[model samples]
Target: MSQSKPEERLALELSCAICLQLYRDPVALPCGHNYCLGCIQNAASAEDPKSPKRCPECREEYGSLETLPKNFKLSSIVDGFLVATTGGGLRGGPTVPCDQCLDNPLAAVKFCTRCEMSLCPSHLKKHEERHRSLHVLVELPAERDGKRCPVHLKVTEYLCVQERLFLCSDCLMEGSHQHHEVQTFEVAKEEMKRVLEELGKSVSDKLQITEALVKSASEGPTDKAEDKLVARANILQNVQYVFSRFSTEITVSIAV
Candidate 1:
């Protein structure tokens, strides 16, 4: 086998294991590895509903889909690498013309994300004169955080519990969330954990009650409750198994 270059090796590491390709709309797991968002979600949902969501790469368990967060920084890097390496255009193909080169619209060398303009090599050099003023991105497209408050242009930082959606700080004070109940990420996580535990206990308790009721109905002077329970347990075994499995799933999901 041919040895891989350092750049190729790094690309491999960044690529999603599920897709076996460059990360697109990447999401980071608690395990610190990233994968395409759709890929991981599909994988988890494809698993038996009774089982914990396991990381395809590490076998790390997650309690719920809410645990994963998008890796925006890594996504930016992946998009840049893809466009640079694959000659990606505005349409995500080759041969997109540079917007600024009025005399000759050559194939773009870079895309200025802030200005939303493509640039040829000469214009790109001029753009670099104050590169810190704007970001240079690749021509390829990827999912980005568009949930920021349109007016403030900052990320929506709070979940408005009453509205059932996220809101940026500006929106909380001046927009629709002013009178709504809100919660931080930490608070929501704790609340979900409590709810999940309660759900598990409730199901387990109901199952035991059902088991007891079955025994009571069958009990007679000759019938020991213990003996009757043993005889009828197999009849309810499948139902019990389903409940037990569901309880485990609820508990594990909350922990994730």
Candidate 2:
């Protein structure tokens, strides 16, 4: 099979599984899995809090999701990737118009999933007032139709583990998926994002360490054959570590 290009691989590394978009405010769990802070928290909230929390990918059990660490390295990498891909043109890209606007459509600031509409500053203010206590606003392109179950034509919010398919609320209520292991999409995405984030971090760490080691070896004394041999061996070891770490990350990412 053909391998993914460098940019494509990096894009995959930077994306969050929950929203299937670039990560925002990524956080790392104890299991080393990375996820968007809000995504993970929302997934955790759905579970019974009394029980131990499990890592989304590995299913490794851990207590408390109260103090997850922010993955600064991965976040920086994502920012840099965005800059490179956008060619410093992050601002003036094509934009989706406000769905609420009729005559002259304005650039939408946020999308209301509940209302299935994009809102501009003016309309958004009104929406907030009307549904002050209950609203679900998200980034643009929620892909509502894409998220619907093909069989039932309802939103596929649930994942049937046994069948490995996304199911709508109706599927569960109708007993078609009775006794099958299931989880919310939020839960499944959280787990997958966690693993991908951890792998991205691991690869970054290895690259940094390898670069430092190579620099050190280049500057080291090599007057004698013995010293030269040692430096070469050290550089070789660092290169091997970096390659192995990257290989592992690619394998895990592809599997995911």
Candidate 3:
């Protein structure tokens, strides 16, 4: 049998790499490989901290972690294309094929600043082993308490109910939040809803008052018009009475 062309072989390989899989949030690595972001992170964390990560297939080095961009346009295109081609197997959802190659959608294993694409876990691990030491691996929500953490640089999720501020878990446990009531996200959401409702009512009342004032202002010209009509009618009546009396005097004088 004749051997498959290199391009065709590459396409086939790419298809196998992402077979039956759609990328969620896609990321890219510096080596131009893609992977699922979550899968990559877990893999990177699983290995011994001392050893470097290696590529799953070629054992090539891959770089550190990064966030994937939501490719909404590509997502829509892939979703439509899959629906048309797969008949019913690929359900319509928010996912897209890789823009560079159609064989697989970009996997969001980790983000790559250099490649600017989402990578699969395999690609992400390789990147971490190879380039993580040189470049920083930035996590999402990149700040906390106006300070940056060495690892994960993400803003901490802890919130203080008494202070009405977001804090790191460490800060919450510190002396600053001692004896203060701490609440979870659900409680905060409920309080926010209540405040929004009160604000909505106040806005509605103000709108109603504004509408009444506008109506009254619109009627001011009409009131002035009515007053002018009444005054003119009264003046006309007085003039008519004077004319009648003058005619009567003329008639009486002629008769005499």
Candidate 4:
């Protein structure tokens, strides 16, 4: 539980002040603080032009700023942390320590979405008994997103039929896929299942055809190849006998 504090603090720092989301294209300022480049730009733009541009967090002044330095290390670290939390969950080492277990220092198995607290096995059992309709996070919901749209950066709600991918509400409206057919994941599930069933039938038909082909091939003509080889060998033997007789006649005529 003591170690969990640092991880949470790091996550808080990595979040962009403007978007209130994880930093995208993180850039370091002169004030030794990091923010998203777009956030910094917007913040700078909102300020007075006569005075030097000041940082939103620290209020540090910068007279002339052409470019912001990329915080590659911080970005990489944040990305890694997000990856660990979002999908793969904790590995050998535990990040979320149990708040309930004080003396033992046990790792948290599940997180209560309502209480925003981690629980160990024993605590989780108690929590289940006490808290009715409790929602526990087995895995953090894909960075709190099922899957984000590539363009809009919002949670993808629908599957695009023509493109064959997930699309957000914004993407479905204004994007190139507006003309294309789409359906919500709820509806798409049944549609996809129907398509899958059709494909399965097609596959079954093809398999039957292939099986028939294989069976016919096995039964069709086993002796044809052997018969051809035997005929060729017999022709060669007859030709050889004729050649030997011809050679004997030539030898006898030459001797005379």
Q: TM-scores for all candidates? A: 0.35, 0.35, 0.27, 0.42
Kindly report which residue pairs in candidate 4 clash with one another: none
CA-only RMSD, every prediction:
21.3, 26.3, 24.5, 20.0
Assess the local accuracy of residue 70 in candidate 3 as a C-alpha lDDT between 0 and 100. Answer: 41
By TM-score, rank the candidates, best first: 4, 1, 2, 3
Model 3 weakest lDDT span, ten residues long: 140-149
* Alpha-carbon local distance difference test for all models: 0.65, 0.68, 0.47, 0.62
Top lDDT: which candidate number?
Answer: 2
For residues 48-76, write the lDDT of model 3, one tens digit per residue.
76776654446566655554344455445
Q: What C-alpha lDDT does candidate 3 achieve relative to the native structure? A: 0.47
Return the candidate ranking by lDDT, descending.
2, 1, 4, 3
For residues 107-152, write the lDDT of model 1, one tens digit per residue: 4556778887766544554566657545856652432223444455
Write the residue-wise lDDT of candidate 4 on 86-171 in tens digits: 33223334245455643332345577887766664445555666765556556433343245565654557887777677888898
When 3 and 4 are scored with TM-score, the better candidate is 4
Give lDDT tens digits, candidate 2, residues 63-167.
666678789998888667655654321233444555565433444556898888876545665677688748898866646324555555445788887777778
Q: What TM-score number comes out for model 3?
A: 0.27
